[model samples]
Target: MFTIARFLTTALVAILFLATLPVHAQDAAPAEAVAAAPAPEAEAGELDGLENPNIDAATLTLRLIPLTAEELEKLSADWLAIVRASTVDVVDEQIRINNTSAELVEEAARARLTEVTESRRALFDKYSTILDAWELKGGDAAKIAGYRTYRSAIIVEETRNTDWRTLLAQATSWVVSADGGLRVATNVGIVLASFLGLLLLARLVRRTVRHWAGRIPNFSKLLVGFSALAAYWLTLAIGLMVVLAALGVNITPLFALIGGASFILAFAMQQTLGNLASGLMIMVNRPFDEGDSVDIGGVSGTVRDVSIVSTTVITPDNQIVVVPNSSVWGNVITNSTASETRRVDLMFGVSYKTPIARAQAELEKVVRSHALVLSEPEPVVRVNALTDSGVEFILRPWTKSENYWAVYWDLTREVKDALDRAGMEEVEAGAPPVVAPPTGVAAAS
Candidate 1:
C-alpha cells in the first residue's frame, strides 16, 4: 500500500511540472516577440540608408542633404567651367602660333626689302658719279627716265679761231644712262630741229656761193654745182651730230658700230671703194676743169662732164667717150686747153725735081701771112725728109686755140691753089707723079 502511494505522488508531481513549464514559455514568447520588432527610429535610419550611402551620417546631418535643383545647378556649373577653361587654352595656343608666324614673315620681308633698297641706292650713286663728271666737263641738261640729267658737250672745230658761237653750233650733248643705254626720244627731236635750222643756213650759204661762182665766168658750172653739194652735205652731217647730242643720245656705240661696218664694207668692196676714193681725189685735186681738152688713158677728147664714177668726153669727131675715174686717175692726163693758144704743124710733099728752097720760102710766106697766126711765136717752114718719090716740107705756126682748125684748113687749101696755078703738074706724060703718104709726107723705102 505505501509503495503505490509513493508512485502516484511522483506522477502527479511530473504532470504539475509540465503544466508550469508551458505557462512560463508562453510568457517568454510575448517578451521575445516584443524584442524582435524594430523601433520607429531604427526603421527611419534604414530609410535614410536608401536615400544616402552613409546612413548614420545622413541621419546625423539631415539639413545638409542636397535638393534636386541644387544638384542640377552644381553639375551644370562644373561642366561650364571645364568647357570654358579648355576653350581658353585652345584659343591661347592658336594665337601664339599665329603671332610667331607673323613675326617671322615680317622679319623676312624687312630683310629682303632692305637688300633691294640698298642695291637700288648703290646703282643710283654710281649714276650720280657719272653725272657729276659730265657736269665738270661743261655739260647740259637732258631728260632721262623722266628726270633731268647732265650731259657732256663735245666740240669739234675745223678752224684756228675757237669761236664759242661756232663751237656751240657744232657741239653735241649725250645723255648716258647708268646702264650705258642712251635715250633716243630727245635725240630724235634735237636732230630734227637742228636739221631744219641747218637747212635754212645752207640756203644762205648756197646764195653766197652762187653769187661768187657767177662773178667768175671762166669757172665751170659743174664745178660750182659740185662744190655747193659738198658744202650742203658737210653741213647736214655736222648738224645731225649736233642734234643727236642735244637730244641726249649717246653716240659712242653708234659710232663704233658704224665704223666697224664701214671697215667691213670697204674691205669687201675693195674695187668699188678704190674707184670712189679715186673719184673723190679727182674732184678735190681739180686735175682738169670742164671744157678742157684732155687725153686720158690714150684717149683724146674734150671733157664734157665729171662724175663720181666716170668722166664724159666729146671728141673732135663728135663721138662720145665715157672713161672710168679709176682710169683717169691712174693714167697720165694732158690738158691741151690749159694754155691760151696752141700751135699747128702742116706737112707737104713735092716732087724731088722741084727746088727745096723755093718750096720752103713759099710755105713760110703762107704761114706768116695767115690772119690767125700768132706773131709772138714766129712761123717756120723747113724741108724735113728726102724719100722714095718726093721731098717733105714741114710748116709750123702758132695760133689762138679757138682758130687752130680754121687756120690749118685755110693754109692747106691756099697752098694747094697756089701750087696748081704755078703749073706744077701732078702727073708727068709717061711717069707717075711723086706719090706721097696720106699724111702729106714722102714714103720711106
Candidate 2:
C-alpha cells in the first residue's frame, strides 16, 4: 500500500509539469513567427511592381536606364524567375478551365487564366527591358538563350490558345494605346533624325574628300572620284550602325550573319572576286582612264568605263567590247594616247635609174609642206635602203598625236602625187609608193 502511493504521487507531479510547459511554449512560438514573417503589404507591393500590367515598355526602359550591366543581368534573372512562376500559374489556370464543366467554376477559371496571362505578358516585357539594357552595354545575344527561349515559349503558348480574332483585336488595341503610340512615334522620330543626319554627314564627307584629294598631285580623277564616293558611303554605313546601337538595337548578330554569308559567297563567286580585286588594283595603279586609247589583252580600243568586274571598251569601228578586269590587269597594257606627239613615217621607192638626191629632196619637201607637222625636229629624208624594186627613201615627220593620222594620210597622197609628177618609173600602178609600218619607223620613206 505504501509503494503504490509513492508511484501515484510521482505520476501526478509529471502530468502537472507537462500541462504547464504547453502554455509557456505556445506563448513563445507566436512571437518567433511574427518576427520571421514579412509584412504582407511589403511583399504584395514587391510582387505588384514586377507583375503590374499597367507598366509599359517605355516606363520600364526608363526605370532600367540607370542600371549597370551587372545590375541588369541580376534584374533579368529576377524577371525570368517571375516569368517562370507566372507561366506555371497560367498553365495551372488553363488546365483548371479545361477540366471544369460547371458554368460558374469554368467562368472563374477563365477569369484567373486571363489575369495570369496578362501578368505573364507584363513579366515578359520587363524581362525584355532588362535584355535591352544588357545589349546596350555591349552584351552578346548568344548569352541570353535561356531568356529568349522562355519568351518564345510564352508567345507560342499564347498563340496556340488565343483565336486569331482576339489576337487581331489585341494588336489593334495596343497600337492605339497611348504607350504603344508614343513608342512608335519615338522610334519613327529617331529613324528620321538618323536618316537626315546621315545625309548631312555623307554630303560633308564627299566635299571634304573631293577637296582634300584634289590637292594631291598623284591622285587621278578616277581615284579621287572613288575616294570621295567611298568616304561618303563609309560615313553613312558607320552612322547607321551607331544610330541602330543608340536605339537599343543589337547589330552584333547582323555582323555575324553577314560574315558567315560572305564566307560562303567567296567560294561560289571566285571569278567575280578575282575581277573585283583586279579592278581595285587598276584603280589604285591607274594604268589607263576613260577615253584613253589602249591596247589591253590584245584588244585595242578606247576605254569607256572600268567597272568593278569588267572594263568597257569601244573599238575604233564603234564596237563595244567588255573584258574582265582580271584579264586586263594580267596582260600587257599599252596606252597610245599617253604621249603628246607621235612620229609619222612614210617610205617611197624610186627606179634605180632615178637620181637618189632628187627623190630625197622631193620627199623632204612634201613632208615639210604639211601644215600639221612640227618644224622643231627637222624632217628626216634620206636613202634608207636599196631594195629589188628601186632605191628607197624614208620620210619621218613629227606631229601632235591628235594630228598624226591627218598628217599621215595627207603626206601619203602628196608624196605619191609628187612621185608621179616626177615621172619615176618605179612608182607604177602595181608598185605602191607609200609603205607605213607598225613601228612608225619605215625602212623606206
Candidate 3:
C-alpha cells in the first residue's frame, strides 16, 4: 500500500510538471527574445515563423552586426524601405575602376565579371525562392524555409532563349531518360499480363462450375451465375491491387480511402444493400427461378428476370412489375411451377336425397377420365360438408403443373354436362335453402 501510494504521488507530480510546460514556454519566449544576446552561429536558427521576408533580412543583419534586438528591428525596417525604394541590381553590376593605360589587365577584368555574374545569380535565386515555393506546391499558402529555388529565374531567362528545336531535343532526351521508359514499360506490361492471365483463369473456373451445374435441375442457375460473376470480379479486384503494387503506388492509402467511401455508401444505401443481401439468400435457397409463375405478396406473375437488387415479374396482362428482393424474401412466395405436379381443388353440390356413395363414385369417375389428370394419386370425391342448401362434395385431382388451369376448367364443364345427362341434380353452389312440406299435413279442401 505504501509503495502504491508512492507510485501514485510520482505519477501526479509528472502530470503536473507536463501541464505547466507550455505555460512556462510561452512566458519565457518574450523574455528570451528581449535578452537579445546573440549566441553562436547555431543559435541563429531561432528566427522561425516570420511572415515578412524583411524579418529574414533583419535576422541576417543581426547575425552580421552586434545590435540589440530593438535597434536591429528598427534598423532592419529602415534598410528594407531603403532597399525596396532603390533597384538593387546596380549592386550586381561590374565595378569599373577607371583603369586607363593598362591599369587593370584582361585577366583581372574577367575575374571581376565572373564575381559580378555570380552575385547577380545568387540574388536572383534568393528572390525566386518565394515564387518557386508557390509554383512547386501548386500555390500552397504556407512558405517553406530553405527550399531549392530555380524555377522563376529559369522561366524569365528562357524568354530570350526560345529555340523550338532545342526545346524538342531536350524533351526527347527526357523521354528516353533511364528512369522513364524501362521502368514504366516493365511495370505496365506486368500489370496487363497478370490481369489477362487472372481473367482467363477466372473464366476457366467459371466454365468448370457451370459445366457441372448444367446437369442439375433448378438448383444450379443461381449458383452458376453468381459463381461466374464472383470469379471474374474477385480476380479483377485482386489483380488491381497487384497492379498498384507493381506501379509503385502505396495501397495503404487506397484501402483507407475505399474503406471510408464504402462506409458512407453502405449507410446511405441500407435498403438497397438489404435487397442485395436478400437476393443472395434467395439465390442460395432456390426459392424461385427465372420463368416460374409465382404469387408473391398478393401479386401473381411470371418471374421474368432475377437480379441482385430486384426481381422483374410479368403479370398475366403482360404488365411488368419490379419488386425489391428484400420484399420478396420477407413475404411468402408461392412458386406455382416449381413442382412437377399440382393439386386442383374444385367443389360441386347435390341434393341431400341423392345417394352420397353414388355421387362420390360418379364424381371420381368424371375426374379420372380427364386426359390431363394423373392416374398415380387417383382422383378423390367426397362429401366435405352439409349445409342448408345442399351436400358440398369436393373433387381433388393431381395433374401436370402445365395442365393445371386447363384441366380445372375442362373437368368442371365436363362434370356438369355428364351429371345432367345422367338425370342427377347438382345443387348449385351457395343456393338458398329449399322449404319442404311441414309435417306432411293434408292440403286445404
Candidate 4:
C-alpha cells in the first residue's frame, strides 16, 4: 500500500510538471520572435544617408526657374514648398538668370510699344492735315486699336472742274451758306446722281437687249429673252455688291445670310423648282414644239403655249388643259403629228361561208376610195382570225392626222354597205347573210 501511494504522488507530480512546461515554452517563443524582428526605419535611414549625404541641406537652398511669364504667374506660394520637398535638384544660378531675362524682356516690350505709338501718332497727324484741307463736314473722329481714324460722310459734294464758274455760282447761291454749310446739299446731290445713274443704266440695258432681240430669229426668242434676263440679273448683283462695299458694310456676313436664305427658298419650293427646270429642258430640247398634237400623260391635245411652270394644251374636244411641266417631263410623250400621218385600223367580220378573197378586195376598194386616206401608203386588208362568229378581217390604212376620224368613219361605213349588198344577193340564192349588228349594239352578241 505504501509503495502504491508513493507511485501515485510521483505520477501527479510528473503531470503537473508537463503542463507547466507547455506554458513556459509559449512564453519563450514570443521573446525569441521579438528579438529576431529587424528595425525597418533604421535600415531605411542608413540607406538614405549612404545614397545622398547632403540631400536635406541641398533641398533647403534649392530654387526653381520658370521659363515663361505664364509659368511664373501659375506658380502658387506653396509650389516652392512642394518643390523643396521633392527629390529633383534645382540650381540657384539658373533661377536667377531666368528671372533677369523675363524682367528685361518685359521692359523691352514696353519701350517698343512706346516707339510704335509715337510713329502711329506722327502718321495720324499727316492724315489729319489732308482731312482738314478738304473742308470736310458732318463727320466724326474716333480711336480704334490705338490708332486715330477720321470718319467722313458717305455723301460728298459734286464738283465739275470743267464748269468751275457755274459750279461756284451755284454753290455760293443755293448750296453753300455763310458758314460754308454744304452737307445737306452734298447729300441731296449724291442721292439724285445715284437715282439717275440707275435709271440710265436700266434704260441702256433694255435698249441693248431689244436691239439684239430684233435681230434674232423668232424661233430663238425664248433663248434671247432668257439670256437678257440672266445678264440683267448679273449686272444688278454686281452693282449691289459695289454699293455695299462703298457703304463699308462687311460682305462676308451678307454672303452667309444670302446662302441661308437661298437654301430655305430652294427647299420650300422644291416642286416648283422642278417644274421650272423641266420646262426649261423641254424648251431647250424641243421634245415637242408648239402646234404639234401629242399624247402626254394620258392627255391627248395640241400644245398651245409652254411656260416655265405649266404647259397649255387645246384638246380635240375644244377643252383647254394646263398640265404641270414636271408631269410632262416625267411621263412618256407620243406625238401623233410627229410623222404628219397615222395608221387607222378597222376590223370587220363576214360569214365563214363568205369568200375571204372577195371580202378583202371589197375592203381595199372602200379604203382607197376615201380621199382622206393617204395613197403613198397602200391600204392592207388581211384575214386576222377565223373567229367563232365569223371570219375576221383587219383593214389597215394610213391617213393625215387631221383627217384621222373622218377617214376612219367613211371607210367603215362604205365597207359595211358593200358587204351588205353582196350578202343580200347571196341570201336571195338561199344562203345565210352575215350582217353586223346595229351601230350601238355589241358585235359579239
Candidate 5:
C-alpha cells in the first residue's frame, strides 16, 4: 500500500512536469497538425463514461498552481466527494460480480471496477500534486494540510484492503525488485543494528540506575529494582521510536493509536491500575522491602518480590502467595524487619503461690543470656496479670530484627526449663497454656 501510493504520486508529478514544460520554437508547427487531427471515438460499452463532471472540473482546477487556500480547499472537497463516490461504485461492482452467475457479466463488472479504481487514483494524484505545490508556495493553512494528510491515509488504507491478493502480489514483487530489494535490505539492516544497540544501551541504563539508586538515601530494594527495570524499558521504548523516526517511519499515528487504546483500557483495567498506583506508593513510602517479614491482608510471609501489580510472599511454611498491590497498600502493613531492632513480647503463667520475685529474676536471666538479644534497651520481666488459676508474667526482650524469632523461641524454651529446674510448679490445668505471642506479634510484618 505504501509503495503503490508513492508510485502513483511520483507518476503524477512526472506527468504534470512534462505538461508544464515550455514549447520550443521548432515544436510550434505541431500545434496546427494536432488541431487538424480527428479525436478518437470511445469504444462500445466501455466503462470510462462513468466519470463525473464535478471530478473533471476538480481535476482541471488542479492544473492551476498556487491557488488561494480557500480555492484549494474547495477543490479538495470536490475531489473528496468524487473519491467517496468511486469507492461506492467499486463496492457496487464487486457486489454485481458476486451475485451474478454469468461469466461475461462478472468480467464486465470487474472491468468497471478497474475503471472506477483508476479514476479514484487519478483524483488522489491530481489533488495531492496541487497540495504539494500549494505548500511549497507557502500556502500552509492547517485545513489545506489536513486534506493531503487524510487523502494519503485513505489511499494507504484502501490500497491494503481493496484486494488482498493484489496487495500481496505487489508486495512480493516489490521485495524482489532491484531497487525495492535494496531498500528493504537497508531498512532491515538498520532495524537489526538499532535493536542491538538499543538493547545494550538499555542494559547499561539499568546498571547505571541500580548503581545510582543505592547511593540514594533510604532507597529500598523494591524501589531500586523498580526504578532500574523502569529505566531499562523506557530507554528501549524511546530509543526504538527515535530509530524508527530516523528511518523515515512516521510514529505519530502509532502514538495516536496508543492514546486511544489507553483511554479504553483505563476503564477495563481499573483494578490493575489501582494495583499499579498502590505499588508505586508502597515503593515511594518505603513501608517494606524485599525479604521483609510482612503481614498484609491476613497473609503472613517474607516479601519475596514486589512488582507494579502484585507482591510475591514466601510463607514460613514454604507456601508462595501473590497479593495484589492494592491489597498490600490498602491493609495495615506490618513490616517486622523494617526497624533495626524489634521487641519480642511473651506471656507465661505459673501457680499463684509461686514466688513472683524469683520467677522474674529467672526470666530476666534467661533473656539476657541469649546471644542475639540486644542489651541497650534492657529486657523487662514483671508480673503482668492475676488470672483465675495463676499469675502471668510479661517478658519483653529487644533483639536485632533478623534474630527476633530465634530470640523469642530460645527464651521461651530456656525459661521453661529454668523454671522447672528451680522447682517452679505449673499453673493449674484450667489456666491458659504457654503459647506463642498474639497474632500481632507473630506477623509483626
Candidate 6:
C-alpha cells in the first residue's frame, strides 16, 4: 500500500511538471498555424474592369501621349521635385531636426518612406500591366489610341469633302499620271534593293558572331547556341527597324506589342522556362555526352541524344525514353563510361576443404593472365567472408570500360574451366554459389 501511494505521488509530480513545461516545436509534427496554405498565384474569375459592361473601351487609359520638348522639360522638373520630396534621406533629416524621441513620430516617418517607395513601385507596375493588356486584349479602338498617343505616331489618315465630279477627276488623274507611276515604281525598286542589301548584312553579322563564339576556348553548347541565335535575331530586328524608317512606318508599336506579349507569356509558361534554364545548366556542366552510358532517376540506359529540352536514352531492351532536362539536372547521374577504365568487382566462394593459399594464388593468376586487365593496378584476391557452407573470396580487376562485360564473361568461363581442370571441390549448391550474382554494364553506346 505504501509503494502504491509513492507511485501515485511520482505520477502526480510528473503530470504537474509536464503541464508547467514550455512548448517546443517538433520537426515531424508542426503547429496548427504552420499548416496554413499559401495564397494562389492568381485570383479566380475575370478581373474587375476586364469583362464589366459598365466600363467603356474608350475610357481605359493604356498609355500617355508623347510630349513636346518644352512640355518634357517642365514634366522632368516636376518629377525631380516629387523625387526630392519623397527621398528617404531628406525625410529622415527632417525627422531628426524635429528632435522627437516619441515612438509614434519615428513610426510616422518610417511609414512615409515606405509609402513613397511602394507608390513608385506600384506606379511602374500599373503602367507595364496597362501596356501589356492593351497589346494583348485591346480591340481596334485601343490600337487606334496607341497609334495616336505613342511617340513617332507616323500613321496619317487623309480626309476630304468630295462629290461625284471631284471623285471622277481624282480617279482620272490616278489612271493617267505616268510621272506618278514612275515615282511609285522607283520607290518600290529602291525598297527592294535596300532590303536585299540588309539581308546580306544580317547574314554577315550572324556568321561573325558564330565565328567569335567558336573562337572561345572551352565554350559550352549553351553559349554557342545562344550567341548565334541572339545575333541572328538582333540583325533581323535591326533590319526591320531600318525598313520601317525607310518607309516612314512607326517602330515603337512593334517592340511594345512584342514586349507585352512576351511578359504575359512568361508567366503562363513558367514550367517550360524552368526546363530551359535546367537545359542551360546541363549544357554548361556536361555531366554526360551524347554517347555516354548513364544511370539516373531509377533508369539505366545509353544516352542517344541530349537536346535543349529533353534527353533521349535507349534502354538495354531497345526501348527509347525521352527525359526532360529539368529531371536529369536535378538528380544524381552515374556515368559508367566517364572514365577510361573501370574496376569490376567479382566474388567467389570455395569449399572449406580447399587450400586457402593455393586458391588465392590460382585466382590471382587467372585474373593476371587475362589480356585486357590492366597490370598497373594489379588484380586483388582475398578472403572476404567465412560462411556456413564455404569461404567467400573477392577478386577486383581493372579493365577498359568498353571491355568490361567481355572481360567479365571470359573470366567467368575461364575460372570455371581452370577449377574443373584442377579437380578441386567447390562450394555446395545450398551455399551462395562459387560465382556471385550476374552483373552487367550498360549496352553499347
TM-scores for every predicted model? 0.51, 0.72, 0.56, 0.45, 0.62, 0.52
Candidate 4, residues 295-329, lDDT tens digits: the string is 99999999887877888899989999999999999
Of candidate 6, the 10-residue stretch with the lowest lDDT total is 151-160
The candidate with the higher lDDT, 3 or 5, is 5
Error in Å for residue 69 of model 1: 90
Model 5 scores worst on lDDT over the 10 consecutive residues at 22-31
TM-score preference between candidates 3 and 5, better one:
5
Give the runs in model 1 whose Cα sits over 4 Å from its true position. 1-194, 206-227, 280-286, 317-319, 425-445
Question: Compared with the true structure, what per-residue lDDT tens digits does model 2 show for residues 166-256?
Answer: 3333344444544344555676799899889899989999999999998999986667777898899999989988887786666876788
Please, what are the lDDT tens digits per residue for candidate 1 over residues 24-129?
1111122222111222232223323323222242232332233232332222223233333443443343344345544354434433333332233233333333
Clash-forming residue pairs, model 5: 334-445, 335-445, 336-445
Q: lDDT (CA) for every model shown? A: 0.54, 0.69, 0.60, 0.53, 0.69, 0.57
User: Over the full model, what C-alpha lDDT does candidate 3 score relative to the true structure?
Assistant: 0.60
Check candidate 2 and list the clashing pairs: 346-445, 347-444, 347-445, 393-445, 394-445, 395-445
lDDT of 6 by residue, 315-391 (tens): 98999999888899988999999899998888777788888898888888899999999997878888887777787
Clash numbers, per candidate: 2, 6, 0, 0, 3, 0
- Tens digit of per-residue lDDT, candidate 3, span 1-445: 7455544544443342232111101111222222224322323534333324344533452343333434333333333333333323322322232232333335455344434333333333233333232333333112211111122223233322322322233233323543333444666688889888888877887787677676677664766677667776877788788777655454655777799999999999999999999999988998888888999998899988888889899999999999999999999999999999999999899887788888887888888888899997877787777767688888889999989999999988988987788677888765544445578787557
RMSD of each: 48.7, 19.3, 19.5, 35.1, 15.2, 29.0
Can you give the lDDT of residue 334 in candidate 5?
88
Predicted structure 2, TM vs. truth: 0.72
C-alpha displacement of 90 in model 6, angstroms? 61
Give the number of the best model, judged by TM-score. Answer: 2
The deviation in Å at residue 347 for candidate 1 is 0.7
- List pairs with backbone clashes in candidate 3: none
Candidate 6, 73: how far from true, in Å? 14
